[model samples]
Target: MKKKYVRLISRAAVWSPRFGGLAFLILLFSILLQRFSVIDVTVFMILIIISACCVVVSLFFAVKALYSLWVYGALGGMKALRGIIYSLTTAIPLVLFWGFWFTLPALHDVSTDIQRPPTFFRTARPSDALPLKSVLIEQAALQMSQWPEMSGRRYDGSPDRIRESVLNVLAAYDWPVIAQKKFKGEEDELYIETVAKSFYLGFISDIVIRLIDEGDTTFVDMRSASRYLPRDFGANAAFIIDFMEALDTEIALLPLSQDEK
Candidate 1:
């Protein structure tokens, strides 16, 4: 009986790292597959669950291996140490993956213009709507506290010049504008709609940019809302900031007028 138990522990020790490594691979693949839309969301979700279970089982085996190593010492101890090292190394990525989310808010929708957010023509409605007054207030406060730099920007240029800069930046990034319209009435206003996709999970986020003529300057306001997840971990804000910075860079690169300079 003692020999049988020792053998069983030894076998588990050898397999723990393999199971943990397998779980890590499945998780990595699930993220990649989801990003490319190669697998159904439900299937990917199941993969995550299965991967978690595998990790748990691996952990159990690892503990058993440690116990066996302590009892048998020598060769058994060395084998168990190898399994522990492999399992710990394999679990690092998964640990970081979830650890990153712990810092972000649990809200899906994000907008630079919370006061008068640009309309979402093709995108889905925000998860926190008017009826959810408390939720909206909390989200607003959170964004204000976390990302005050996400607000609108004013460019010192003619409406046409600013519009050109915006279009140039958008095109340079290959954002694939879905709908864009410019109407000249009381004020020259341009509305543009685009989509942003995540690098890992291929998650979609709808973005809107509104440019309105303000006499000698043009005012730009943008809003970005995710299509699926309730929390984006500041991706939407990052997208808006990137576009604004790119637009500024593009505008600066343009030839300057003698009078303006």
Candidate 2:
């Protein structure tokens, strides 16, 4: 009977290694998560240390459990503690590390940005060749970068307030304003020209706002350019808000039904 009991314990110990191996694999993933760049470096580093300790501690417990069960013919408390320790420690860091690791990078991808501005040779003007005006606008919009503000970092103002503020600025600057027909859909393209110096300026909307100077109007545009607007305003932020506000203003003036909302 004693020999049979010992044989059973030895087999369980052999199988016990499989559990530790699986847990080690999970710990490896957690370690990699801690290395991601978008994760807050401080948080990641702290968790990384914790995770390393967890891996080592879990391994110790696992080995202790096997040794106690198979080598000594008894598990003591190590058998239960082994699964509990390894699972809890591994699970916690794995969830936390990967959560921040994947989320931040996707949220802040520079390519997705549409609020950056393009370089401009000068301020865009109505005069000169139409081809030049079209090309400049197209190129400028293409170069625009995404706005980086997230839900947490967003300003107190809503899109409506922002649009109103922007329009008020445009009116203050004596810049001719036109209300877009709609939100300009996902992509908004425009060709506007103002005659000024020999240099001309063009603007585009994307993650970053790109401005290109095509003619003698090397001067920056104060109305549409971020230089004239708020630095936090993203590529489509100003344009979208202002357009939406203009639509609302037009609707208010029309005396439409309240049910429309």
Candidate 3:
């Protein structure tokens, strides 16, 4: 009778795909839980880190198994290939996010008016998680350098009209208004506070829009700050830009009043 032989790497390869599958499921569940508000950001982040580690471990075993098969004629080649495929598929999105973390400015808060950014009201659930004012100023400077078009807009309309347009745009974007108020002793100045969620991760962000009436013109300034991470990978700035562009289109689509025509 011939003696059976089983290589160590072959055994590892057999188990690698199982471990990779577990990691993939964990990553998916964590994201879904976070997105649906079933879990908090801190817990979600920890789970993501764990899943990422599992992916790395599985990949390591898969690579070792492949090396063993090539050098020592080990079995389990198909298993090793499956593990490698699973690990890479799970890693692509994480790798892209990590790339953004390094490439973009490290800012979670952004505003059209850096010197006097729109303030978040109590209803928006403001947090002290933000950095110091000085640090924010430095970060805002960097943001401005990168996104120079991120500045206040002046529209040839009354604050009331512009506020309507702003609200319409917000509704279109699905940002829920949490609070709104008129500036104290300044009836013409309107403040609207809203919350935005990232499309995929559902990460929450606080947004405030300030509309100041200057005769017939309204000056619009907006501020957006992430609730969880200190680095937003430009999400806040992108949010403001998209909103502004939408509002611009919305206002343009509005029919000219009898007086204007």
lDDT digits (tens) for residues 1-261 of candidate 1: 355432444776777777877877888889888888787556776887787777777788778877776777413455555556655665676676566667777766666677667775554444542211112444788888888877788888776778777778878877878887877788888888888887667767778898888888889888777765656767888888888888778877878756478
Q: lDDT of each prediction vs. the true structure?
A: 0.73, 0.37, 0.82
TM-scores for all candidates: the values are 0.80, 0.29, 0.89
Estimate, for each residue in 1-261, the C-alpha lDDT of model 2 and write its tens digit: 355443334333334444544565645654455334233334444655665555555556556666766557664444535555565656675566457455432221122122332223344423321122112233333334333321111222233333344355445434454332222333332223221110111122222211123222111122233221112123324443443344335434543234334
- Which number leads on lDDT? 3
Ranked by TM-score, top first: 3, 1, 2
lDDT of 3 by residue, 37-141 (tens): 798788988888888888898898898888888989888788988887888877887788678878878778889887777776654354545543422565666
| Residue-pair clash count for candidate 1 | 4
Q: Which residue segments of model 3 deviate by more than 4 Å?
A: 1-9, 124-136, 185-187
Task: Report the number of the highest-TM-score candidate.
Answer: 3
Where model 1 places Cα greater than 4 Å from the true spot, the runs are 1-9, 40-45, 72-83, 123-138, 183-188, 257-261
Pull out the clashing pairs in model 1: 35-201, 35-202, 107-230, 108-230
The runs of at least 3 residues in candidate 2 whose Cα sits more than 4 Å from the true structure, single-residue gaps closed, are: 1-40, 78-83, 86-89, 92-261
